[model samples]
Target: MRSSFARSGLLTAGLCAAVALSTPALAQDKIKVGLILTLSGPAAALGQQARAAFEMALKDLGGKLGGREVELVVADDELKPDVAVTKVKGLIDRDKVDVVVGPTFSNILGAIAKPVTDAKVFLISPNAGPSPLAGKGCSPFFFATSYQNDQVHQVSGKVAQSRGYKTLYLLAPNYQAGKDAIAGVKRDYKGQIVEESYVPLNTLDFQSELAKIAAAKPDAVFTFMPGGMGVNLIKQYKQAGLADRIPLLSSFTVDESTLPAQGDAALGMFAGSNWAPDLDNPQNKAFVAAYVAQQKAVPATYAFQAYDAALLLDGALKATGGKTDDKEALRAAFLKADFTSLRGAFKFSRNGFPVQDFYLTKVGKRPDGKLETQIVEKVFSDYVDSYLPECSIK
Candidate 1:
């Protein structure tokens, strides 16, 4: 009886030790991520596409990021800056997420960037690469999977200049990105600016802007309206009889996110982009196929960038051996960008924004009757953001 009791005591001790050891291992095998976006309002389509693409990427990776199971917490910023700050704080303080990914607009990014970085947590922007973040406001903890706010618009400006547009009319929302778009177009466009108009963000009624464009009668109209605003502006621009009279050159105004709504009105319209469905690369082909199959729609730059964000995190975590505790090691791993991007050639600039190709794309109807942005020509190859010189980091 005494021998049996001693053996039982030993077994209990071994079981307790095993449980204690396994607990920490299991805890370390999972990492939490917070996904915040403008999942509501007129721009909801953009956020929805991003959310779907990230989820699709997660699924493609067998629900693991760098061999660690991902615990994803999604929040809707409703395109409001204050709401974004509050939600991001909750992710940091309450959920203790290891990484934070996105609010889709520049204004929201401006609101939340300081808070997330101040906490020493990694923040990745799948969209909305505001100019300030790319310059003096750059942060070690902040990275953008998208181009700088001005890069695509710069592509538009170059295209306009090459096409010999001598006079151009510009319009954008009155916000940081809006201002950036105007600056980008003007950077390379050494021409007569007939007029520059700034409207409030999310202004669905463009009758006044359309009137202004008509009155200006520039050689071309370059505008940067996005989301539902894009839809309304394009439709109203066509309805107001300006579509044929003057060419419309834009960025983000007639994209995959808004194309469905813009429909035939946006057909043959040109925009600047970093990727298109017809971009011929194995990774891009596969991604486009999967996105169309699953989502029943063409993936926009927003979707591709968000998908890339997932790949970015996966690659960085793999380089860190799935460890999120070491900030410097993780940041270095991200700087390496050890994953094949959907954009064929992608790398990080000094400011942690993408250095990739830019394209002049045209909206065309696919054989299957689905509308998509198709690549017309590569505008800039391996383009680095112009703000690289301002970043303090090497």
Candidate 2:
């Protein structure tokens, strides 16, 4: 007996083919794009924001790319790797999508990599940029719109070292991505690490960890916690009266998405990211204004990256004359990186990871006292991923 997922895939594939066949008169040539995101879990906000921005991008493109109509299909991975793999398979087999935009978490991306690559589907990640993919295991079809997992953290570490912090306490979830983040920190942070704590994923209570941090008495603290974990951690740190004493430095933790919920607790924290809401450029200014008009909230790194991915797709489609079936043409077009990115200067490394500036962002209160992220400094200028040399892609 076939598994339920297998049966569902067959049904969906048949249905999709039938729709295409039956509506031949209505079938204008189109580009089918599938987005797989964690849309129903603790990290749902990330996907929600990405979806919102991508929709705006579609609108900006007049709902068309390369003179072809767009067929957009979205799926919720529910933050489960198994679910993500099934969804990827369905998108390729059932939906006949031309491109797969995301599976936001690294684990899910890792799970679906082989299947998507095997299918020769272009998988452009807007958020997750795992180390393995950047190095020896690089896939020609895989491109990261976001920085590598370690690159942003590595910038934060370099900044910390420049600031002369002598000792640090590191906190992150116990996962491959989290471990990679810590390694990035250690690579650049010259200070001695007083303590390293790996919390279970989605563990809400940071009280135990906070107690340990306080006892360790490190000069500064670093973390890569994102989503709800950031809110809980920052709030608890403030409540424990350590907010002022030990500076909180992070990557992807204290952003516009997390700062509003954290309020003043997140204020003064430093974070490293490729784009900030207030980047000074016409493209960025336009994106920020449009995003604010749509989302009614300041855009975060996730939103910027997703919007950039849409633009990248548009450029590629234009170059390919909307011929998504010509995979080689699309791949070559994507490698050109011709779009105006939200980040001022953007390009991909030989490994397909991003080579771009990383900004040091600070959480601050607007004149109206609402929280926002400001670009405090540029932590890394046109930096390339360290894993590129390990990649054998010619």
Best candidate, lDDT-wise?
1
TM-scores for every candidate against the unseen true structure: 0.96, 0.92
> After superposition, which runs of candidate 2 have C-alpha atoms over 4 Å from their true positions?
1-28
- Residue lDDT tens for model 1, 104-174: 99999999999999999999999998999999999999999998999999988998999999999999999
Give the Cα lDDT of each candidate.
0.93, 0.86
lDDT of 2 by residue, 1-394 (tens): 9999999999999999988887953654777889988888678888888888888889999998776888999999988889898988999999988889986778888898889988999999989988999999998899989978998888779988999999999999988789889988988887899998999887778999899988999888999888888888889999999998889899878887787788878878888788787789999999988887777788888888999999999888889877777777888888888799988787877778878988888988766566778888887888888889999998
Report the alpha-carbon TM-score of model 2 versus the true structure: 0.92
lDDT of 2: 0.86
Clashing pairs in 2: none
Q: Candidate 1, which ten residues in sequence have the lowest lDDT sum?
A: 343-352
